[model samples]
Target: MRRRTPRVRPAALAFATLFGLADAAAQTSYQSMGRLFTTPSERMMLERQRSDNRAAAAAPATPAGPALPPVPEAAPAPPPAPQRVGGFVRRSDGRATVWVDDEARETTLPRVAPGAPLPVDLGGRNVIIKPGQSYDPSNGTIQDPR
Candidate 1:
């Protein structure tokens, strides 16, 4: 009596072939790949390797002169200018002018809810922000912190 073999799907056959090829290519070594010690080497071989590595590492292959003093690298460029500051809120508006110590500075801030902390930069000084006040670039004044 003749035995019948199971028929394989063409898609499955192709997938199996491709997957096998990719896996074979990815795993090219016949030896153990990782530190899991799946296939350990002979004790003598490991001892020999360890000894060779120790000898090679203990002494520099090349005879080199004393190391030179390392020249200090230039100090890193100063950090970027401070962008934001912590302070009390004076007004919450998208368009507002600010005063940076005698010099009037025009700055725009997003609209903020009433009673929320308003950001007021008074010439690098602390300033309190009032609620419901929009930051009008034209009129920059009286933004003093409480």
Candidate 2:
């Protein structure tokens, strides 16, 4: 009696088909006009799409991830007002000219401390001088305290 060869199992054949050589075109999606595609332009377009799909399928896969949030900006600042500074400077004279912020004192005394406050009567009103500041008597300037 002659020995019989064993037939290929259905499961084995199915697995071979499932994991076998894959056609690059099958991996990509493209429009198909089926048997209706007839014109030269349509045929050329279909042929071009086939080539594009083949190239795309051959390329490696890229990783997908979530997007990041945008950052916020700050507002602009304001400019500063003008400032006046400095105290009195006495020269060789009988009356010491005491100057405040900008005004030079008319009533010259014999001696006084460099930054010490001086009392002056402006129209029967007394005014005290401060350091690094001056009083403009001509302009009737009123300086704010720091």
Candidate 3:
């Protein structure tokens, strides 16, 4: 009886070599071109920041100039008018429901503490309404709880 030896196929060997080379090329290209691409505006902003840093580093220390008259601060703006009416309603399931006059649906609102006062814009007056209490939107007054 004669013994035969096992042989490797040429096509299979070529496919394995091709895949190995492709994987290595992909890793090399990613390492070479991995810098993040930025938009034109971002590039300009970065350039401006770099120039400012360079200028500050190059400038020499000098004595302060004469103290100019202190610029007057602008007056603070007034508070905005109330836009809508809303309040909290305590549910039997230990959660509160927030009802807004303009919104179509009421959402579950969790309070930091139970019975905490929730701010509501009633007409033009800002009123603090507690859970389980009702309010009148027309007059901005609290109504008897139902």
Candidate 4:
């Protein structure tokens, strides 16, 4: 028995070639070409910008006004001294006295509250200090113990 091979028809070969070329063209990218070319509107905009830059460069620069005197740089200020005060509590003649700035200031120990303000004199200046708080005589800053 003799074996006969299947033959490809001319119409089938042409159809295959056409479809293959069509698929290849559909898959091909055109981004590089797009970057190389610009639309008419874009070209006009570019030309307008170039003309504006050229006009600005050709125009005469305005004369500068009289130069102002250079400002002198100020020296850095020194750090402020620490504002702190030390006090000691003393009981004399059955009266509570707070010694601040080496002066005795009397206060009612029974009337002083933990959070309430207690009036006291520091260096002849009246200042308020809470029972559980610290007082700064230099700046009159109150610091809560809590």
Off by over 4 Å in 3: 1-15, 23-76, 87-89, 100-127, 130-146
The TM-score measured for candidate 1 stands at 0.26
Q: Write the per-residue lDDT of candidate 3 for residues 1-146, one digit (tens) a residue.
A: 99999888999999999999999999999999977745888889889999999999899967599767989999887654333334456677755556655453344444556667676544445567664566665445676455
CA displacement after TM-score superposition, residue 42 of candidate 3 (Å): 28
Clashes of 4: 0
Cα lDDT of model 4 overall? 0.63
lDDT of 2 at 64: 72
| Residue-by-residue lDDT tens digits, candidate 2, 41-71 | 9999999999999999999967576655666
| Candidate 1, 57-144: lDDT as tens digits | 9986774888779999999876433222222233455456544433445666656675565566543544455543333233444433
lDDT of 1 at 69: 91
| Alpha carbon lDDT of each predicted model | 0.56, 0.60, 0.65, 0.63
Q: Please estimate how well model 3 matches the true structure, expressed as its whole-model Cα lDDT.
A: 0.65
The window of 10 residues in a row where model 3 has the poorest summed lDDT is 79-88
Clash number for each model: 16, 6, 0, 0
Please rank every candidate by lDDT, starting with the best: 3, 4, 2, 1
